[model samples]
Target chain A: MSQPIDKQRRAFLATASGAAAATAVAPGVFLHAVAEAAPRDSAVSDSVRYGMLIDTSKCAEGCTDCVSACDRENGLDMLLKPEGASDQHWDMQRPRWIRQVKLKNNLTGRVTALPMMCQHCEHPPCVDVCPTGASFRRADGIVMVDRHTCIGCRYCMMACPYNARSFIHESVRLKPTATPRGKGCVESCNFCVHRLDNGGTTTACQDACQHGAIVFGDLRDPNSAVSKALAQYPSEQIRADLKLNTGVRYTDI
Target chain B: MSKIHYREWGIESPRYWGLLAVLAAIVALGGFATLYMEHEGHWVTGMTNQVVWGTPHVFAIFLIVAASGALNVASIGSVFGQKMYKPLARLSGLMAITLLVGGLIVLVLDLGQPARLIVAMTTYNFKSIFAWNIYLYVGFLAIVAVYLFTMMERKANRYSHGVGVLAFVWRLILTTGTGSIFGFIVARQGYDAAIMAPMFIIMSFAYGMALYLLVLMFTFNTDERPLGDMVVRRLKNLLGVFVAAIFYFTLVYHLTNLYGTENHAYEAFILRDGGVYTWVFWLGWVLLGMVVPMGILFHPALGAQRGAITIAALLVVLGGLSAIYVIVIGGQAFPMSMFPGYTVIESGYYDGVDGMARAYSPSLPEFLLGLGGIALALLATFVAVRLLQFLPTSLADEVVDPHLAK
Candidate 1:
């Protein structure tokens, strides 16, 4: 039987061996090369505007896989209640990055269930109202809080039209390396920027969804899946009346 | 004109120390509450993600705007060239600084990261109204300090008019900034109106004057200084005008909201359906804060009486708190409109359940914390008056009005 060699794995092995050899031969040069190679184009660029498209028509009612997955990914599940707080109270107090919302149309008598998170508006009110400049939008269109400077004033939470932001009311414990959160700062969904930095194309919610309801891609690229879907379908922003120009869009809402 | 003498409070009586000790105890209690809330996180307070700013903000903002208004008496003296008010100017400047410090302390202590206040002071987000307010607040402090100096020293008295004018204009801008904090919030339906700025300015006038009168009366009576009917009558009438102006602004604000079809829901919620908020609006803001005080101020039998004026002033202060509570807490209680026509039937988060308003009840710590701010302001005033020459020796009709002496 003829077997094909794993060429990419072989190349990786060769690179690893070469790096080890260089480290032994000249430690200083090896360190310099390693430092130069490690950055991996992490600088955010405006050329790619990351966004999401939710096909609410395909979204099933009472499906909370996306919410649970978001919790696991962001370490939101590890939030602890204060000593005497009831479980019900803690549920309301804990930070929720994403939630499955069920909306009923009064005129049409139609019901729909869709996942709601940060709309990541081009003109985010949260960013505009933040006194400390801690709530900011990346060049790539990801809105996030810089926890170090958040100051926990909760003004951003008031300014958010979608109620996307949550204040960390209690101390956090057992958080994942990818997500770092603490008490007193506002937090929201970041479109899984950690996964994107690691070269993963899909978010935890998108990956976990069984109904194929969520699509995540670069909106600036016409060839990207999100762009193509937006072009081919009629999509609606949650609060289009605000004219926030949200990066997140939904179809058949 | 007789040369007016300024004197330190100089009341070394046990009663004075006892009053100081009570105020100090209240301040200590507030400090303790702050530490407890900070250590336990915001979970201890009724403030949730929905109602981010709770009772503390109501008090902080009240004290802040009142600080600017407190300086108005001095402005009348120096800027408007009212000779009768000149003697009151020094005390006005002192109250402005002390009240501002007290208000700022409550605001800082309530922050999520109080330790990171240095970041707030240093960092600049020019687009934010809050950032502009930080500058406005600090600048007001500096201007008032200089304004105080100009009033105190004989050498600096020539520059008093210039400094007083600057401080007067600075406070108008300061109060405008305070109102704009609410006005610029485009997301909330209860706010985001152009009228908020002017309304706040008027409110500052009413609240500040009421507080100033109470302070003046308490201080003069305690020190046995000759406070006369002439000065008291002028202040009382001026306060009535301010209170009436506030009523006018509030009426116009609600009327403007009523005209807009989009604002009907908000108006209805605040005016009617909102349970505690409705009570606060009609009873606290309208009945007690406005109508009752207005009746007392304009009454044929009671308006001129000193005892009646004091009661009216106290009522106005209570009413001011009610108005602020209605604005701040009530505004947050109403849910944001995520979908205009659709109702949220189910949600993982508290999306107001069925388009209903969120519930909020002020805890003991929250009220204690708010009252602590007031105590702090009074304590500062008490100590400063005792240490420095802030109070005028006399405001007798014959002394204040030279014509009366003649």
Candidate 2:
């Protein structure tokens, strides 16, 4: 399936007539124009389902560029170690949006390295188990936690198959404008929603990967980079047995 | 038949005052601990990204499960028509309400954002088992209270049996909801079994009965009232049977898990090489909790003695706690196998490195918070018994059992 090919039309109309002409267009079409034109305050639509494709064979071992980029983008790196907390304890307690994972086949002894984060499943267990409906999936298929409503019972953390979600243990003093994190709320990868909302076409991790291993685009659009990569390469979800229909796809691992 | 007369605990001795003081102190300490944890965040506790639920959950779940089973005494008298158990029915309903309140307090206080509990109450995802549990716990308190009222009021006594039956069914549903909280989680190897629901039901029967017996003995003895051998003997025997049922379910749960090729690693972790968890399972749950208690409860000489029976009951309580610990903490300790056939060689996250169990040591704040829940339950029971006519005047063989009276 492809999105209605109107980027050129919207881009031309945005430049020629600006906001006044946009009001005459239908809401769906106007939002599409807003998304294309990099408007800061545009409602996300289901017309595009964002996803990612990771080529694990091309992902270099010991490379933490994607992980570091995610930390910076989400303001996770801004968190400081609480008073008297040991390094070992801090490592386990801290929130992580994404992390590098190296896997070895038990029998074949094949070593594969890739970045692990939220799979953004069509059927997310975390979303189903949240008692207050704090964990929700956006219309564009991004799963995120509503920190304001989160009671921080950690039931979502328990239900997550990917172990991708993290609970912010101690109080957070500093955070980026894009992300508002606090103690006691469960959080995970939202595929750079701030970047997407600002009309940026790429994720922090995808931009940081020097090897061009990470592809980020709308999966529903057949012509998008992610869809093209998924069709070209043999890719699989981390836990395919659960049939979660994950948006994040991996190859050669 | 002589009518059973109810009375409040009247003798305000130094021991009674001392007991109340101690319970209050512990409850205060628990409140302080909760504040400390809240201020510092959960980082102060043993819980981490891997093991989210910790000691508080163990205490909360045990009390909640036992709260349901505590009502079984009343269910026997009112629903099953056991005349011998009718005298203890008031205390049974009271204990049910108190224990549930205590457990729910712990559950709410232990949340990462405890201040936002109102959000949990107002907004709900009905699909979640946690949300269903909110209703179950509240309904249990309400139903048990109404059941208690029906039992105590002479004019309302006729409706006691009908209310008792409803309370009985509601407790069953409550336990089922509690069990389904873990059972419904398909992500973990340790959980996701349909058997968890029924296993938890049996567990409630065992744990609840054990605590009820202890409370009965303590209260009756303190009041200098007559408690008969016939009633105690019957309770001990029932406790023994409940212990045996727990064993059967534990065996079935493991046997089923062992049969699944995918579950083999998890089974081995809990049964064999998982150092702390394995010992807790064998020694804490099986040895001290079950085997020792069963031995004392079944022996003709030991089972007949009140002291021996109390020891057995205490052991059951300890065992029940251990069983919950093994289920909650141990289950979480074992990492979810993200890549079924591959070993996670390296990762920033633990990722069950080298297939080892994640470390979790319960913190002081969490432990105190848990004890606070226990203390709160005991204090409530004590105050309720003293202020209200929850205890019957006598449980003598002649008074309780009509055959013995003749």
Candidate 3:
């Protein structure tokens, strides 16, 4: 099985240059075109596809307006209410669309406010490994958890490359009204599926950016700010060694 | 109605109904708590983030592993003639099935969405160890059930010996799979070996034998035959072997971890550094779970003496229970960091037994519910016994005596 896969790689590479010139067929004759076109670029176009770029240098620390925008738009506060006798619905942790990650760089003696969430990898391990097909990646690259069918096994918890998933160990009703209620099963970053589906320009993080430090765009368009930023500036994704082909990008400044 | 009397397996009337009532009340308490939690959520239980999986998952996995060993005796002895274990075979099989069910109940109550458990089988992450474990656990129980059914089917009831043989072989593989669930987790310091599966198998045999002896003792309290002196000796011998195997498993598990480089492993070292779980690991698990029990059985006075063996059996049961607590809690208490110089993040009491950041002491309700699962197992077994006569009514000496089989 490993041998055949290697041979296919060899054959695919042999035809790469020939296929590049024949592009008018579009969505076309070669698989490598599909690979390159599956952009990590920052370009947000008129197309339906969406992406995020995190700027670590000017984290605009202490400002939680993005979190507030998310909480308000997503009805997240409702999920944290204490379990009441009358309430039948359990509060989901409403996987964080954006989170503040404070990373301490030992050598530099600097603490950076890196608001981290899901990287939303191109070769998402979560989706590939889900036996029951509960984890999936859409054609446009948003990863989703079908909460309706989740079995609460928390296997994805162990498999996650990022400690991104959280198990809802308790009922939402029993939490403080602001408890960010979640129960049973598991969840993590969903990239604001509700907002993206409605053709919103960017997520709460992008809208909340006072410094315009955050960017959202389509890599396919090649003209978006994210694309231009990546082209000119040098930055990196966390754990680049992992090779997830993640859609999320970051710039130091 | 006069109580029916028989003498084949040392049969005589005994009043076990009082034991039955106390057990029933505990079962009801457990069931009541579980029902409350289900209606509410796991919030009704004492578990929290740091201690996300507490007593329920701990005991559930322990019992499941123990049951695999218990079932092994029947599979090995009854079908394959591992004569060293033949005499204890029937009781081991019965105890194995009951314990597996008991373990399953503990896990179900621990779920945030207990009702959603069926979805695990329905929608599995084929790549996740957690998903595979659920499947292995279920599959093991199913094989055990068939093995038991066939054992009881007799000449008049239909079935072949081949299925029983398959069950026996499958059980060895099943135990190995269970061990691997913990062993393969390179990230978790506590479980990293091929040995845990076999270790778990040995543990089950020990637990099952302990349970069988206790049950048999109760069954034969008034009988003239005394369940046979020879049968007692045979079981004690097996108990000794299991203890040695368990001891070997413990040593190898630790030695491998000492050499391997993982954060969970470095954390495991903390277990011996006079931490909350250190004493529990050393005295409770090493001395008590393995050494003392083994010591009692190795002595001739304890080994040959009927009363001594019973006391020995009780100690073994307690030791097994302590082993489960130490292994599970020790594994969890490990700080998330995997490196030495980086220092593990210590939170609340939940991470350790003291210092109180994320401390968790299973509440009265949680403890009661935990004990209730055992009570439920006993009551279930008892009611079944009254209705089913699961113990044979007519072994040559009525309670299995190799001496009398001569």
Q: Pick the candidate with the highest TM-score.
A: 1
Candidate 1 clash pair list: none
Give each model's whole-structure lDDT: 0.90, 0.93, 0.61
Alpha-carbon runs more than 4 Å astray in model 1:
A1-35, A38-42
Where model 2 places Cα greater than 4 Å from the true spot, the runs are: A1-42
The sequence of per-residue lDDT tens digits that candidate 3 reaches over residues B236-312 is 78787887887887777776666767533344454545365677777767787678778888887767777777877
**Can you write out model 1's per-residue Cα lDDT over B134-234, one digit (the tens) per residue?**
99999999999999998899999999999999999999999999998889888889988989999999999999999999999999988889999999989
TM-score of each: 0.94, 0.94, 0.76
Compute the lDDT of residue B294 as modeled in candidate 2.
Answer: 93
Please write out the lDDT profile of model 3 over residues A159-251, one tens digit for every residue. Answer: 444545556644555333322334675665666665655445577667877877778776666788777777777877655655777778778
- Best candidate according to lDDT: 2
Candidate 2: tens digits of C-alpha lDDT, residues B109-151:
9999999999999999998999999999999898889999998
Question: Candidate 3, B6: how far from true, in Å?
Answer: 10
Candidate with better DockQ, 1 vs 3:
1
Model 2, position B396: C-alpha lDDT score? 89
Listed in order, the DockQ scores are: 0.59, 0.63, 0.14
